[model samples]
Target: MPAEQKSGAARALAELSDFSMKIARGQRMLDRVKDEHVQIATADKEIVFREDKTTLYRYKSTAERKVSVPVLVAYGQIGRYTMTDLQEDRSMLRNLLALGVDVYAVDWGSPSRSDRWLKFEDYVDVYLNDCIEFICREHGIEAINLLGICEGGVFSLCYAALNPERVKNLILTITPVDFHQDQAEGRVNHGLLNLWTRGMSDDDVDRLIEASGNLPGELTGYVFSQMTPGATLSKYNVGLLDTFDDEKKLLNFLRMEKWLADRPHHPGEAAKQLLINLYKNNEMIRGEFQLGERTVDLSDISMPVLNVYAKDDHIIPPKTTQALRDAVGTSDYQEIGLEGGHVGVFVSGKSQGVLAKGIVEWLSERDAPSARD
Candidate 1:
């Protein structure tokens, strides 16, 4: 055969294979999209309680235990807590519950135009304290274990610092204490936040809030994508392709996709404070930060703290999370390094046994009757 003819045949074969793969990929995406439609329709089954503004999720478990400890799960404000309950099999909430934990997750419910003026102080001093008190009061316990995720972990740290006596055990997962930009990727540029907020008045901020009625998820997702451009595109494509076959896997994949893409618009003033104090100024970890009238000094947090960090996390680098080891005053502190990225720490199978088990064991150890006495 002539070399030119042979080469042309090879290229044609490659093109046909690629076309087949594209068709398969399109069908998979459609299936996942359909799965998401069903999930949204049945979101109510997952809810346990709803008050005026807060929606709390109850994780049911049949595990028999000697001492049951109530846990308050605090997740990031930008995303919903359903990420922890992505699926029955891979759900962190279910996993914890199965370990004989009485878990109650906090859902801040979508913020409305009226909430745009809300500040960090409101979260740390008002909502967090109230939630802790409510859970303790309801359970007839003096204190409860607090497990915080991402920004929620930051909130937990502040809460523990302010009211250490109310927190029996503190578990911080993929939480960022050090806001050093050099160590982190996808960090919000304070300059950009300031630039965005400087020209805006209270009315303008209010208008943006009223227009969206809690910032739409699309806008927040875009900001996150900008943090790691290539990784976001490449990794998710790989993930979607990898889980294309199994329906159960596909459901979990789509749920995480919905949660990831469904970022909420944080209230402008509150976001402004977070960007300035943490991202721009790096104050919270520095002990110079003040939330309302209360000061946030890690040294004031003397309760038992369990710090877990995702080794491959880029958004909140391991170093950034690990900084809590030195920053906190808790003499009983333990840091465990997990083999996964930010999202992987919760979703990846590698995390199921290690990270999830670590959480159960740590809480059990801390809540042991002897440990308290």
Candidate 2:
């Protein structure tokens, strides 16, 4: 054999040896991995406001200083807000704080059996406004910035529409608003949510929510797992075996798994409205989504808007979020398409850099005196 060929063969054999040893080591560590618990959402925060199961947390400025107006982060009630702060180094919350951005996040704490009757109106109208008003009052500002993700983005849109005077800028990520849009049009891939809900009737929605009181978190996790069944099985079966030797990679993967497995049950009344009113009837875009006595009009949100969606998002597909520009009342609306799947856009190291940098630049430019006044 040639000298180059011999060297190449030697290198390949070395890698194979390493791979085999790593898998063996990983297999031994498998049982021990069950006892490992990594803490999350470890940023410094104070309870600025609390009502029943809901609490709004204001993160202390870790940077030298912060923006004049604070930004409130509203995460989906379907899951814990801790995903944004997945770990110490990879947390979006910590990254934002390091960039001199004042941040607050709402925690719709895990609900109970008696809390079944809690409606969407309670979440959007009462709890949302309560937090917003408190933030504005505490900061001594008229209007502050609002950042919403997923179902929380829906709440931010409704709140901004209902009380435009309290929101200076609106930032939404991975929020599905226009549920009625044709699934096959302008999409890299058709959304599973659209397909799943399209066939579900009002009775079907009511039947599920009514029987269970709240939509079970386990069921939600199962549905998400089914989205990529092969990948799901591989994680527990083979994927971890291959990766377990790399401590950092294994830890991060396990952290994500921990979060995914900790899903929160959806409030029954809100789940019903989400399925029947928003998902089935597509009420949000049509100005039929009601909170209290009034329909939520997206056009009422006349503030600077930053809409972001992942191009490869299977849950809330890019087309679903990109449609916001047409319905929005603000001429200052902007859109950004990140190159990855939905959750990966936030937690993955490469995309987290892009997301944080994009947001910091977007908000920094608009952080003038006029933005608050």
Candidate 3:
């Protein structure tokens, strides 16, 4: 054979060998892997409180308690709180607990069609308030620190604003304050959710909720997948292939997939309020967003606020979260820009420590006797 043909043949043989090795490794991995190997949210915790579909959990940690006031972590109903405690090594909940923080997380359990009438008032006013009251009564303290993630951050803002006396310190992560900031800042890549919702009309939103009874998790997952179509494709293809040979990496991938697959249905009335009242009408920033009888005035939140946002967050948008600084009433407002995307803030190795540390230090500063009152 000619030299060119020989070189081509050698390249083909090398490719074939690499493919065969990958297949063998994948087969071995599949055979060895079990359901328990990919289990997520494995941190130990006991049920502290429960109401309807919501449950509050107090994490059991051997670390010395540093802060006197406990923290109630409220994650948005869109996704489960398990993302924070994804795994033993990559868990923000564990990271905080290891740092001597009294951590409590609220799990907004799966909502069914019967929960269609449930609104933000039920979440913020009823469920969240009950959890806070329970924590206060248990600790014999007037108030506790509040850590809100994503949509939960919005609920926190509403709660802190409405009942400022009940919240000692407020920490918001990857939360959207000004929903329209994306268009105002002219960021094409950011706030796809905001833009998509804005494109929707009031009638369209109502019709959606009416037809579906509640916003389906699968539908929301599809929408999220649509946000980054290429990445979504690459995640299961190139991403899965790369992890097939490595047990640890493969487990990590599976854990995340588990979390992603567990999106909960957002209640219909709440979904309508979120998509129309907040996203389209821009009511929250305007001090017009209503929860029950009270409007959520951002300026009413007088507590020391620590606003954390992911620098590369595409869903919430950096500007959308940063908008909280000026809108909030507190003079002691501080912002920490972490190095990651929306979910990466909790899952990324580099960010896990930074996020938990930032929260601990911020809480400790305000948690002092003088500040606590």
Assess candidate 2 and give its TM-score to the true structure: 0.91
The candidate maximizing lDDT is 3
Error of 1 at 311 (Å): 0.6
Runs of candidate 3 with Cα error greater than 4 angstroms are 369-373
Best by TM-score: 3
What is the lDDT ranking, best to worst?
3, 2, 1
What C-alpha lDDT do the candidate models reach, one value each? Answer: 0.73, 0.84, 0.90
Off by over 4 Å in 2: 1-20, 28-37, 186-189, 369-373
TM-score of 3: 0.97
CA error at residue 138 for candidate 2, angstroms: 0.9
lDDT of 2 by residue, 1-373 (tens): 9999999999999999988888788766655565345666778999988999999999988887546678899998677889999988788888889888989999999987778988888988899889988987776788888999999999899899998988889999999888866374666345766778778887888888888799988988988888777888888768777667676677777888889989999999888888788888889988888987888999998999999998788888777788889998989989999988878888888776788778888988888533334
* lDDT tens readout by residue for model 1, 29-69: 66546543525312222465565466766555557652366
Clashes of 2: 0
Model 1, which residues run further than 4 Å from truth? 1-11, 14-51, 181-217, 234-249, 368-373
Candidate 1, position 128, lDDT: 74
